[model samples]
Target: MAAAVASLYRRVLPSPPAVDFASPEGKRLFAEALAAGTMEGFFPLVSCFQTQSEPAFCGLASLAVVLNALSIDPGRRWKGPWRWFDESMLDCCEPLDKVKAEGITFGKVACLARCSGANVQSFRANLATIDDLRRHLVRCVSSQDCHLIASYHRQAFKQTGTGHFSPIGGYHAGQDMALILDVARFKYPPHWVPLRLLWDAMNMTDDSTGLLRGFMLISRKTAAPSSLYTVSCRDENWKSMAKYCVEDLPNLLKGDNLDNVQTLLSRLIESLPAEAEALIKWVVEVRRKEEGDPSLSKEEKERLFLKENVLQQVRDTRLFAIVHDLQYANNPCCNCSSSSEEDSLTRIAAAVCCQGAAMLSGNLASRHGFCCKETCLKCIQANGDGLKTVISASVVSEGNEHGVDMLLPMSSPGASSCNSNLKNNVVKYPSSADVLTVLLLALHPSTWLGIKDEKLKAELQTLVSTDNLPDDLKREIMHLRRQLYYLKTCKEKEEYEDDDLPSPKWLG
Candidate 1:
């Protein structure tokens, strides 16, 4: 049985035009390219070459090699005492089991890369010229700083398979050839194909996306991936959550007292999976206090520092206070005007803008906030109770630079779709910043301020005092206090600047 199985493995797929790297002609071409100094990508790619875990995982395998070669930290533990990229961990966009069975497409591959924190430039063959592709191929193969992945029809090279993905290991400018570092090492060796031929292969349409197959230029992001939160790249579930935030959540806030709003906040927090809730709490309460031991190695210290810096940025956003302001915007006694539904919607829009922007680390307000605001106002006016389902918001931009879209399904007011059922499938967790947002809002001064109930105010004050609060919560509150003070001073300075009087140096 062993002999027969080995015999089956020995058979090579029918690839005609491609020259196997081990063959004499292929070796000659490679040596010539090396001597000509065109093999820049070869060394890095060869060092990180990987075999696909499954036949349909060529994209995943190719991506892992580039990610590792770029030295990007995976953020999550790959094994004890280490973090690395592997095929199994590339499920930020699609499930591993699904990718193992059905393979992945160019867009999804790009989505995964974006979520994983790479700076990716994707080009569809139909939209790009052959000359344009040649320029990219030459630039990638001549540099170790970036890498390229070719998504092409395997049969275009006379291979037996259909769609496939592999990294371009080198480019021979004089000969106009590209060295393909095939990920499916079980069937094929690294092969050389003419650059134009590779272009022809990529120009074919992908049935899954109904777009031409393409190539992606991937490199390490200037900033590392966030250690605190990640976007759920799943389309439908993200939409449902966004719709909930834009429509349902604000509706729940209307005319409700602090007690009811607190209950609602708890309900939303409870909606998260146990794993997600635990992760958020651990990051907030535990990780914040972890000033890594100076006794550890330099690399460990750098990782710890990166984690601390990102978390500090989250803290600096004062997201919790913003969320608190939104929740209390509709209070009967608050200064917010809601005499007309239009006014109410406008306030909701502003709150949503602040909440979404804060959750997104301000990217949403600059890029997509106006669109979301306009959509909400129009939907409320045109539809009322029949408000259309929002396809997405900035939930996916939590730690993402490109702000990938995540979709969610909308249910009726009482029938929420944002629940733990989304765990490990469509969503990861609510943004840690969002969880912190609600957590901090609970301690906001407005929650207890102007209250007639002396007993309730005293109880809340007691809960917020340093003696009653946990160390981590206390630190967070202090951070919020400092941040709010800074904002107040800045606003005052701006007001003074607007007048004829010189701005105060003390404020500065």
Candidate 2:
């Protein structure tokens, strides 16, 4: 009876058309690639290959395998004090529940990689030719330091699914074939696919992103901290906190009564814990450029220290004062104090910066627009002079065409001051966050007190009124609000309430 059952199952099971990696033909394909020295990337991938934990975890599993293969630090504690990349830890871009309901997009996967400390360059199929993909595959497969993940329509290969993600393990130059270390092991085995066929599959559109599915080349990030104002991307309450910034904040600051605003801000500040502080310590690299090389120049070792000092001075003079002022706003008796105006100003600035950064940083980056820490720091520093110049000019209404700048800088005396190169690279148009930051900073009661020119004060007030806002500013606000709703729907954490427990009865 068992023999009959085995024979019946064998007869009924259907075989896949693609050449299986463990099959005889597949072995020959790999052997040929190996003999041709085109399989250098295979060993590392094969050793670290993993299957998807859930039906929709192909992207996460594939990313985990590549991350581990590159030996990038996961940063958070995994099981038993081990810091490793797993499917469960790849939640930086979207919530796991949403990912389970609907798999992630190629852009989101790249976003997750960037947030998890990996460098990624993603390519969409509709944007590039088949030769372009061929070149990337050859380069990735011939190099062990980097890896490739393909997001394709499985139906293109006559497979049993729609969209799928898998790491490419090897390439056969002569056959023009690539080896897919499929993460969905239960549905499909590892197989060799024709390069053209794979490209065609990837060239199809992903319904989720309305973009063509494609590939991502991932590598490890090895750079120092970038900015003095890095945000807390790991904060779980950032979602709720950000909603308060865009929604409840306008209503809170609606009136012109200084004391009322100050009192409200003070109460809000006191209600939150110190852990709610958003801006973290900005660290600069102080170590020698190269160890055991006494000949290493002093210039090399001191590269970032000067920049760090410049940034710290700017942050303190511009943003930190606001943070310090808001922290002490809870004292009602201080409303009539000498620093009352300053405190009111700082409270508004600090609250806006904290929540603004949370909203901006929480959004996933675009596919090809991954900004590293070094780049972020450079952008902040480079924009410093332009931002300061604009603020000094006191023409906030000029922000129609060129959006308002945010990060402010202090006057520096010597060579440690901001460089001319930084001044030359001022971003033409600031983001919506920068514009909003400028508007919030303009709301400082101290700003109004110092401004004797009614025109300047009126221009500042124009920024706060929704009806008087420029079309561009209105569009940016609407765009941010839409993105907030989309993100909340996709990444919001689910909450559940505990039910009452039944009482136990004892009979003696």
Candidate 3:
């Protein structure tokens, strides 16, 4: 019966691509296949959007990859190559936010492409047949003329989600699959997908415009992938913006009163997920009406809002709810240790100044850098919602230096505490490093590192073997161990910079 179900699933749903698209050996095979007139390899190189901040801009992110592949600047009028990020494309193009809020439309996509100065041609049902698509896609790409993108239902390929947008780097006609370059690399790897299934997905009408899904091509004459752009993460404008976001978020989390909280929330609405933003808007309106009309005093508004709005409805938002749960879980023990005094910014400063890498210490934000091995054996896993802040903080400047790395100084108030003789300085928005380190730490560094996966598993065993954690923390530890096993053991691991967080040469 199990075998029968497996067989039936295989027949009904197209399997994901099995190619090792990340290895150097894999790179060689792919290049040879492409040069020999087969679309069977990854694009020579593409900057991945792993650890991306926004959840809904998959289409825009995929489009960014397509535009980057063609060396086309989505923001044509924008100053330098460094001036525009993949997120820059999404943020600058307001239509994308609406597409995320309302729904993605072909017209919106076309406008985004045309704004990049590319001559785009859309191919779809009846507008072009399967044979027509095969000719255009296979011939142009195989012949080294151009590349194209496909819009399809992710479930057609047995993926977990609904609609998706991704670029196709190769075509394997014998098996009849188009090699899909998924921009949501963190969620799914680059894989081969069946054309018939892709077409079926495309044939489904769009709810936004009642039109079928399709492919978009930037003509051969105008499109060519550019190699000069290293990445836009080092840009001054974006980094400065990141600094502001980092400082503001923690403060917003620490907001003491209703008025201050509202003002802070208004500033962060654009950066938040749709549900959270909408909830904030509704609550703000309630306050506006009641406070302005004299039906309630400011104090009454605050009390009513906290009880009727924040305490209940705020949790309805996916991001905020997760944050709240983690907050409660972490609040009881945040500053219990000597190393727990520094905030996120100070942690970033210590790593950058003391080690020249942007990373974080454990739960304290920064640490004293001693007794690590001894502490590791007994310390409970640093579990909290603060780890989410790392991603939130990173979202701003992840593109600032090298696509989500922050260029920060090697000095802070706590730098001397870890190492000797580092001068103190005021810190602003934490660097890209702060976000990266925290994110890596959030996963409980032991499992994320290739060298430490098994060793940490053993360490976790020892910690769990000991006595006396609160029931909630022990629950967190159990959850962490399960997740750790998955992270450490997951198959088809890509050579994403070796899954090791970036560090300074001195740290090595």
Candidate 4:
């Protein structure tokens, strides 16, 4: 049955476009394929990364592979299968043994081998000397296009504690300075570092709130993937990671109420070094002017000073336009409006953003106050009546109880109703009273009116007449009929209408 379902999914879903390594169009298509959820496209995409010599693409491709696998079999809870595959591909020990016979550093070769399977217990145990690992890792880092190698090194330093050369401060401070330089080189290279690293670094230092900002950065950077993206992206581990990230973020934010923008900005600024103090001071001044009571002239002077400094730095980096664009979005000069609908949408968008952010940010928000169970409870509490009605209606229609508790209104009664009727020797309806009880439960909230299933409605209508149901169900059904009729009559006579209705001006 599962195979049939999988086949049907494929039959209905079109294959992704072919990726060409030679052209920008090819890269875009590959990215699209990765984003579209095509698991099968992941390997091909990663292959493109290898050919293009673009490390960012390689890191992203690996991520896509991991994410795709998770999406397909989230229930399986697979662990580090990629590490196994990576190790098998390198087979470093055989070559290393041959090289050992020659008495060379052989660092580059060791690094390459380790990159594939650094997570493996054997690799972790063996890659002892930083120079040996750094030699290989640094080759990729210096190349600027070796994203996979860079990523592997970053992971290695993070995991194995590279003596004095940890990219991240305070981990292995007393280790060799050369090793530390290697770690730092991979981390803060002149060119683009993987966004995942930036995000992870931020999360490891800060908390859930910090992670949320990272996700917003991703959403702003990349285009969203469709169902096809999943297939093409095809890294089960990556998919799982992404899903876990997405699901966990909202729960994390909700737990601590870290929703303040000011708090977020402060955290970002705090993450910088002492050399960044001037920049931080400038940021604070600008923020104060924006939110402070100051003379117009003073505000103008402050703004001009900040702009001149920013422009100077932009020119120095030769990234003026990009900096201008970023500043434009962050600046108050941009004309943006807030609406109630926009607010609601932002909340939903934030939820989605958190998902991707959560994964790349490591498991930052996975702990803390973010509890899925709590989120579920809050969702139920917020829409108590509506959810109860929907669950009740689903239960009545499905006629089974998989695990749903009608007693707990938020419990999805549909699962219960579907499962209950399947059991052997169980009285399906129990009695007419049970039928009427379910109907009354369904009618309590306005949300039920939106349930458009004709058959479900028809089944409900059948219950309106007591004759078809068992005695107990019939009794309950009659009670509902009485209550509904009374309300209808009361409504017609205006007895339930507000007494504060005003008289017309002409009558006055």
Candidate 5:
């Protein structure tokens, strides 16, 4: 699946208009810079970071790039001229610095800065003095602040044609340094309690980079332990934090202790607000990624898939049910007759039937040429209404082919004599209910004339006896059986059709 997705990405990403970052040149430059370990070569990256209006996107993209790079070179430590840039780039921006000090690292700070010609030294210096600014102005400036500072700095370094750290002392440098300090202080603070909490929240520590990636994807703005500032926070930032939390799940699942991971997952799910349905979806996606195929007999893999898929479906279905209920309550008996609850119920029923059929098909595919006798027996024993519905429908269709007019609804056909015999034959010892009943029924010439086995007969009887069977399903089975019975009776009786009676299409 991963390979298929990768192939799809490759196919879709290379076309014109389909791939949009900006101008064709900009897109090319962006791709090149991404490949070259520096965003300094890309105008779009520089522009994006510089604009800084959407820090989440910039931050996420940066993290993705960094992670991709690290994945490629898992054993190597990030080093060279980029090291100083990494350390100082985010330090220059107050908000960026805060994010970093809160355990988020300068993953793409160096790359983005190198791409944009932001005055890195000056920006860093300004961090210190920026604190004294009026709260209103500071807020305004902070809101307008561009992530481009890093890109700008990177551009300067590239233009200089030197990897050496050349500190050109100036007003900008001074300002940048001040801002860096302020950001650092804002992120860490003087208080020990917050620091301890932050430390405790760090989920993973990269030994090579000495960087901490958070396990708990809680938003600093929303999770500040104060409701007073709630109105001031951006919802998007909270969502970004949630994404990080979800992205970390696969790694967390792969951790040493699975029980601990499951506990954490439960707590995370519990803590999620009702509005964060997307976050829940992301968690499901992460779980899917972490889990292996359930078909595997291996205990660990099967357990993981079962836990993940079931939990995901439960969460999704609950959300869906809630939304549906609210919508129904809000618009009780809307005049739109075409969009009725009955229609929805029918659709759900069809979906259930389709799912059952697909599952059976999958089983058949896996066991190619091997009869699913055991699985069928289990289904019979489990008596899943949905599975029973599908099996009865299938058998009705099969019986129609051989001209059997069993009047029973598709839920229960009195025990099939042939199926009973097969079951008894397969198993050494069978109860009287299981053996004698089916055998006695099978011995009858009428039952044997059309019916092949007790299983098929039982399925037909189930179809005939199902009281709540959908009208459409009933009509379909009745129509098919009528056609088959007519054909059989016509062939036996040799009655000449009157001109008024339409000739059967099959007769032609």
Candidate 6:
């Protein structure tokens, strides 16, 4: 009876002891790292810092290093529905004993990084060979585009330690070694380790997942907008589109087009000769310099800016020239020119940028023409007849000349049950940034490319396959695909063809 009662109530395990903080050797090592420019440089991490007051937190400590490196502002844009993930809510900083007891996992850590907008990718290390490990370092850490979080067993590497997490700052290829920026400063100093040893360490099985401990790469996510947004071809909207497209051009050119203009121009921005980068920056300064000068009247200032800042030299680069040429080669751009010289330069920049986006996304870019700004592909389809007329005429059309109203009701007869069932319960996206892309993909059956039944599952499978793609994105695509599939099926059953369908407001 006594043994049975004891078995019914488990004993609370004691927390692990903390690492020594004030050791003289630890301070010296930290100072050396500071001198080597290892920390994020925003703030100093003292010798005594540990992620948790009690128990092991090498993972949390390592995470702090990466987040700090990314210049993450813990207070801004990070507090939302996912605020539960904030440092304040974390067991390390918060008094959440239960959470501390539960600990963190590779999956949880990866999710947090994604939520923080880091393009994070993880690979299993159990099967990684020594050469495979070298390749990972060369492609990730050595490239400088990513900071790696290494999960490995210290004992496996012959270190008097257990499982540990840390970042690798760089690689010494000639030496066949890596610079380990260990976050557990008190336990282990930052140092160089041979590739073979590191590989063996990574191959250690993780206690939590029953999988080999490996590494994750975190960097800024691809900042380009998808191919769905396009430059408007309509006369009224073209000017505004041109002006707005300048800042967005770099990304637009780099979107998902098969031609991939970025293949040729991706590195052009950074690869520019110093003189060219200076010249690009100077172009904007030319106008600003005039704006600040006291001697020049407003009119003279404008003249100087136009003459000096808007230089043919700046525009003559191989990059801008190709972009500008592509814009002109495009048809229907004949006389939609801007009246103001300032507006002209702005529009030129916009055209160049739009062309760049077209290159990146493999989508056709419009130069001076109007593009339909409808929210959904169905809306675009509803205006297909008008779109053809306007596009073919090679001229700007105004104000729904083809009567661009929604052709399908928000709730169709066949889809009403499905739509109603999932309406309020639809999965929410972590960010609204990629809605246009998902909406476009959900348009029609042929576009589905044979993904008919279980369309939502198919869409999710496609999204989940993307490296470092967030779970929220997969959920969003699933919800949108569900709505779209139902809508398409319902529309097919309707007797009326395109024009006879419901009006544009149905998209609401």
State which candidate has the highest TM-score: 1
lDDT (tens digit, per residue) of candidate 1 on 1-508: 3554433353373545788888888889899888877788888888988998789999999999999888887765443334678786786567666787899877767667766767677787766888988898878877888899999998778886889999999877777888999999887889999888899999888877667888889888765454433444222353344344334444443423545334544545444433332212222101100221213345544444444444333333333333334434434233223344334334444434333333234222243333332323221111222332122232223343221111111112212123322111111122343454523333335434443445544654443344444333344444333223222332233211112223233111
Clashing pairs counted in every model: 10, 0, 10, 58, 53, 21
User: What TM-scores do the predictions have?
Assistant: 0.57, 0.52, 0.38, 0.15, 0.18, 0.35
Error of 5 at 317 (Å): 11
Best-to-worst ranking by lDDT: 1, 2, 3, 6, 5, 4
| lDDT (Cα atoms) of all candidates against the true structure | 0.55, 0.53, 0.39, 0.24, 0.24, 0.38
In the range 1-508, model 4's lDDT, one tens digit per residue, is 3454432111111111111223464344334433542223224223322111122222222322322322311211112111112211221122322222331122222222222212111112122233433333333223322222222323322332211111110011111111111222222311222233333322231121111111100001011111000111111232332232234322332333334433322332233233321111111111111222222234333333333332222222212222223333354332123343234333332332232222222222231222111111111222222221101101111222111111111112122222222121111111111221333222223222322445543443343333444333233333333233222322233212112222222111
Error of 5 at 336 (Å): 18
lDDT string for model 3 (196-253, tens) is: 7777777777665556777877532243211111112112243333333334444443
Candidate 3 TM-score, true structure as reference: 0.38
TM-score of candidate 2 on Cα atoms, chains taken together: 0.52
Candidate 3: where is the Cα deviation over 4 Å?
A: 1-32, 40-53, 73-85, 90-96, 143-145, 220-508
- Per-residue CA lDDT of candidate 2, range 28-77, in tens? 99999998877888888878888898889899999999999988866433
State the lDDT of candidate 6 residue by residue for 75-175, as single tens digits: 21122111112332232111233334655555555544544445565655744467766676666543445667777777754566577777766555544
Indicate whether candidate 1 or candidate 3 has the larger TM-score. 1
Task: Write the candidate numbers in order of decreasing TM-score.
Answer: 1, 2, 3, 6, 5, 4
Give the per-residue Cα lDDT of candidate 2 at 77.
32
- Using lDDT as the yardstick, the better of models 5 and 6 is 6
Compare the candidates by lDDT and give the number of the best one: 1
